[model samples]
Target: MSSYLYRLGRSSAAHPWRVISAWILLVATAAALASSFGAPMRDDWDVPGARAQQGIDLLREHGVGGFASARVVVHDREGDPLPSAEIGTLTERLRGLEHVADVGPARLSGDRDTAVLTVQYAEPITHPDLMGNIEPLGGAISGTVDSGLQVELGGEVPDTAGEAFGGTGELVGVGIALLILVIALGSAVGAGLPIAAAVAGLAAGSSGIALLAATMTVSTSAPMVASMVGLGVGIDYALLLVTRHVEHLRLGHDAVESAGRAVATSGRSVVFAAVTVLVSLMGLRLAGLSTYDSFGLATAIAVVFVAAAALTLVPALCRLGGRKLLPRAVRRNRPLRTREPLTARWAARVGRKPLVWALVSLGALLVLAAPVLDLRTWPGDASSQPAGNTTRQAYDLVAAELGPGANGPLTVVVPTSATGAADEAVATLRADDRIAGLEPVVTTPDGALSIITAEPAFRPTDERTPDLIDDLRAALPASAEVTGWTPFFSDISDMLQERLWLVIAFVVGVSVLLLALMFRSVLVPLKAAAMNLLSITAAYGVLVAVFQWGWAAELIGVDQPMPISSWMPILQFAILFGLSMDYEVFLLSRIREDYLRTGDPRGSVVRGLSATGRVITSAAAIMVVVFLGFATEGDVVVKQLGLGMAVAIVLDATLVRMVLVPATMSLLGHWNWWLPGWLDRLLPTVRVEVEDEPAPERELVGV
Candidate 1:
């Protein structure tokens, strides 16, 4: 592997302009393709084989393409239901809008302070232009506002549009990463090279995803997430190569040899880390969710581009800069280290007190992870919207006037042999305490399917809603099934829970095998997996504390505590596991290198820590900063992802990497590198560290 990378880097350095030109051409072509054929991404949350999915299929078979309905809520501050005259005017205008199939009669709240008009679309609210189609509805309503009258739109359509922060988080993340790189490398040119590579890689990635959207059901959030992951990892990958190349240059190696050696060593780590990430993300397919699959695949593509560019583009750029990578003054007055690096010093201290540090770090992580026991996974609803946003205001108004459950009503379809079950269902439903009200039953033309709408007594976000669903299923005929927004989301959550264990097992199994192959150690992979999971669990606890427990929810732009997104845990684990493996590969691979050289476990730990600690921490810091920037986004789900990832990276980098890793390695002694002869023979030899080969002897006759 090292020889291959050395040859590849040598070629790239030998023809630096060709590598740079090829990257430019690829980026330009991708951008052009994206601009020409790219379409907006859609979120697909439907769970295959779920009960709700069956109901939806039935509805689609019935030629009922327009199952998505919304509410245009008008609040009259004059203490009267939206004037019947005004309701007629708004309803007439809404009926005339494109994609709008029907506008139901206005229903006034019992308090006569608000009126809601139900608007049905001609198809499921999945179109990219849904917001464009609905903008006129809001605009029309706003014009009617007078004398304390307010208008807002809510329901499936508006929710599908979500909120756009216009990539602000990505920009802030890049800026902070640039500062960190500058500080670490101590040269603007040195730092800028990685940032530039990251930008180019992200641009190419976005273009590729945009093109993929033509055939695949990519989520709207995929680009945002891909950019977030790409920027951080891209910078880190390039930073590693550039840092190593500079070290080689300082050791008196020429530009080409330095680039070759750097890529041979550090570049291998980047590829291993990237492969781990891709493997982890691919585990999302085990959950059987299109949205998760889309995000996972999209992010995997971005990481591929960044990782490839780090090996090819970054080395080319490093060769181009040559001695310019360092400031002139520093290069001329380079000083040798007289004292051990701080990382080595700290490692020595922890090595002597391995048990104490290990216990303290493990105990802290476990404590932080305890809150995950109470974690709830549900699709966040209108309640998670910004406080003053129209959707949130409308939700608050309905919950205040009509009841929380009125915000989302369940639609039940039952195949009846006669009117007997239907009549019994109405009576039984009314008598049930959880059923707030029953809409008139509408039977199919063939009388084969009877549709009954039941309004629950609690909101979709309510814990009791799941109970209500269970109770209704129990009371209804065996042929009857309940489905709607609430039930649909609940079904997704249930599906995720069922597959969670399988996905975890698959991810862990595959990850362990990969680590074992890379490190050639059974115990090393096991320890890495355990540490990765510990950090991830700690992150989940943070999500529960902040989003579920409403701890400083407002500070992050959430109006109230909400259930974690159904896809969050699955997505989080996949991404975080992969990211955690990155640090694992960086740290452990370095330690393995040192161990092989010194054959002293204690000394190797200190030496390895000193060599790679600053780089790893800087890399982790870049990732954490990028993730935290996303946490400030207006979309609650994305916000949760950002917060959760940020917390996980922090825990993994500081507690797990800085403390637990060194302590554990110290405690394990030489056993850390042990692989049984039988297993070692069975596994393929994958080497990430290569000893520096002596420069070929040159003939002195010419001189």
Candidate 2:
């Protein structure tokens, strides 16, 4: 396997022009297509939901213009006319304003105390600025005249999360990215390459993703995701490859040879690591979840581009760097040596204190994982939302004064063996205090299907409100199987339950399966899995404590502790798991290769650590750079994801790779290589070789 890679390395060098040109063409074309077809990324990036469609339908049915069609809801002290005599006088005064088709004679809602105002408008709500009209909707009622009451505004616009939910992501994303990069890289130059690569890759890759999305029916988030991961890994892989090449030049190899050397060793490692990430991400297909499927597929595409860039552009640049970058002392040239003492030192330690190291690392990881025990999940509702989205604001207004259930419609469906059966179910649900407004449509007349439009006064992500979903399900008639935004959410609840195991199995099983093949050992995979699990658990705990439980919240600038979003764990697991595989593959491949060549378990572990550990650190550093970029995106979720990933990468690189892997291997001794002989025979061997001369300008150093 090494020889094959060695040959590939030689060939790429021998035909650098061809390999290089192909890459240029690919990227250039990709850039063009991407830009020409690119679309601005939008969040909630999901398709228009049934509720949105229903609302649109209702507007059309009523032929409601933006003015007269608008509905203003006011809730105060449970028994307030809302705009009292003083308030109503103010409301009446504004009734004569232009664009006011009609201000209905205000009346209380079904609850009998809160009032609903019908504001007739001349236009449909467009830009947020137009929402200024909401201030006047308060008409005669709000301000000092209605000082005793808490008057919250809810009209056509606020019902959509209002104008305030705008640009939250943009502001947050930028701030977080800047802070992360400055801290992680330390030096300006160190930060530049990764950021440059990430920016360029994202710019080009997003365009490609857009074109693909147009043709492929992709989810809205695909483009942003593709851009994010593409920039991250592209810069990361390039970082390691270039850094290795530079080090070789520093050692006194010719530029071409140094480039070849870097390409063969570090570049090959990247291919393997990236492929591992791709494979792990591909597990999404088995998750039986479309969201995961989209995420996995888009991520895989980005990985492919990253791999290509590392192998091609990075090497081309390395070759170009040559004598210009190599120090005079390094370029002077000397006899080459392959022996590495650093490996020997690690080997000695493993043989000496493996048990202590392993326990300490494992224990530390467990402490981090502790936060998972109290993990809280939140839905994608207004308050818990990243903030500034119209839906988020509108939902917040409804929930703040109304009650917890305000954002979604509740649908009641009965197993109607006959017609009108649905009507009875609808009526039964209507009588329930939990539901308020009723709008039935599109179902067969057998009353088998009826719809109730009820909003949760609390945010969707709130624990208390989701409980209502459970209550509605449990309390509703046995004949009814509810399905609406609330239930479609609840509706998929069971399905997701069934698939969570599949997701876990796919991630764990594939990881183990790959390790078994790479090391030809059952024990290696088991140990690797254990180590990875510990690391992942620890990272999750940290996130939960910092973000969810808000431990040391002030340090992170979180104003308050909020429950973890419901989808956060899933997204976090997918990303972290895939990234964990990145470091895992890099380290294991090196160790296994060394073991196969030297057949010295202890020495192999040490040697592997020595040869690859530095590079692993470099790779992790680049990944941190990538993650830090996202933190700057200014959105809370982006910040969490970025920081979470950055922390996890730093952990895997230093603590897990540098310390624990070696220590554990020392304790395991030959058990690290233990495998059924027959099964071992089935494992495929992979090899990488460096051929051709080291770049004329570079030389091996400290060998």
Candidate 3:
């Protein structure tokens, strides 16, 4: 592997412009074909399961060409049981509108604060853009509604449209990320590199996923997740290598020599980091669930792409640009600034109280992580019009005025039994204490099953809803089955919990083993695994505080609290575990390099931390912008993903990398580098990191 890398560097060095121009062309081609080559990453885009498929199938069959239609519940602030005269008037007006084939037999429930209206579209349900009918409905209803009524359209149509709306957010987020890079790196070239790296790296990641998506149903969250993870790490890797190259060139080394040194150092670190992150992410597959499996594959592929680009494309770019990369004054005074410093002042603090700093930093992370223990996994209510819109106001006013379950129903598909067993199963569910209003599903004589709609008093993940499913599952006779929105949600939750440990174990265990083999010390991998886990927990805690607890939704632009994304835990594990290691590997590899050369454990950490810390932070600050940018997104899936990762990166860089690591090393002393005598004797000490200045630059023959 080392030989292969060496050869690559040599080849890239010889035909530097070719390598550079190749990457440029590749990136251009990728951007041009991005949408076509890498399809949008959406959940419902191709949801599986017999239930979801059946719904789509039924919608298509019914000639709803657009999709199976859903009812929009426009709320009336005046109350659910608005005067009968008004209900009749409003219903007639909406029913008469174009594309609205049928106005639901809407009813004001006994509570008198909410109503359900069924809408049927005239176009074929599969008409690609099914929501074409819905937009007009919202516009017509919003304007035509009596002031007292607040409108909400439930069912799949609005949810799908809401998700589509997030595509706009993706573009907005990209621009914001670019702006942030300029602020952090202080050069448009520097700022642009990360975004460019991300664009290229993630394009490759998505292309890889297209292969996976073709074969298996990836978790809906995979693309959203891999995009951020790949972008952050890709940029971090590029920033480290590029900045180091720039620093080298400033010292009088030609672009080729500087590029070589930067790669020899930062390239090594980026590879280590990428490998570590890959191990961490693959651990999620240990959970043995599809959602996590999707996460593991999506992120692992991205790590490899980013790491490759960092070493190959970045160096090539530096060499291609030549003297143009350096500032004019630096070109004149290059030799003075380029000389390597033996060690910074802070690196000399190796003998300080490592334990004190370690504990202090660790404790701070624990505090930030504390709130996650209280985390509520509420599925955020899906709404249209900023949360305050009449639709939202009506939703809140009605939900508050009536009760929580006043929202629309969860759709469940059951076997159509002429013997009435299917109906009995539903009746059994309606009789359960957990459910509110249950509706029968009408099926064609052809035997296509339909969904029974029901409103559950508790949240989707609420125990009552799952318990009700259990009761119905028990009540079913031979040849009968029941599954819909709530049951499927329950199954997914149960699957996640059951598989979470496997993922954690696999991710941690595999990463540690790999780290151990690479570094030849058990402590190296163990500390990394522990520190990464700590970072993740702290991030989740932050997620709970903000998105879950609704602490500062306005600051982040979230209009309301939402239930956690169904796939968030796995997404969190896949992205956070992978990324935490990106920084961990960056910092650790530098320390390892120092330790190997100086044979001083304490001295190694100090110099290593000091050297890598600033770069890590610079990389993180750029990532924070990308992440926080998406926090403004309307999609709950994107928001949770963005905030969760952003929070994790911040905590990892500040607490885990900067403070906690130093303190722990201070306390452990030589123990940090300990290896058993017999094992040490058997093992050939491989220099994974070197403390010495890069050996006097070595030149290679012509290509």
Clashes of each: 0, 80, 35
TM-score of predicted model 3?
0.79
TM-score for all models, in order of appearance: 0.96, 0.74, 0.79
For model 1, the local distance difference test gives 0.84
Candidate 1 lDDT score at position 224: 79
lDDT, candidate 3, 9-75, per-residue tens: 5466667668767776765665556545554443443235333344445545645322345555655
The window of 10 residues in a row where model 3 has the poorest summed lDDT is: 694-703
If ranked by TM-score, best first, what sequence of candidates would result? 1, 3, 2
Ranking under lDDT, best-scoring first? Answer: 1, 3, 2
lDDT of 2 by residue, 276-301 (tens): 67766776666455556666777777
* Candidate 3 Cα lDDT to native: 0.65
Q: Per-residue alpha-carbon lDDT of model 1 for 1-703, expressed as tens digits?
A: 8889999888888889999999999999999999899767886655666777777766666654326677898887677655677778888888887777789878788877788888887766665556424676776676567535788788888776667675787678778988998888878889899988888888899899998888899988788778878888898899988988877776677788889988999989999999998998899988887877888888988999999899999889998898888645556665534677789999999999999999999999999999999988887888888886778888888888888888988888766675577777787788998889988988766657778888888888887777777788898777777877788888888888888888889899999999998888999999999999999999999899988898987788776778888878888898899999998998888888888878999998888889899898888888888888888888788899999999999999899988999999999999998999999999998887667467644311211
RMSD of 1: 3.1
Better of 1 and 3 by lDDT: 1
- Cand. 2 TM to true fold: 0.74
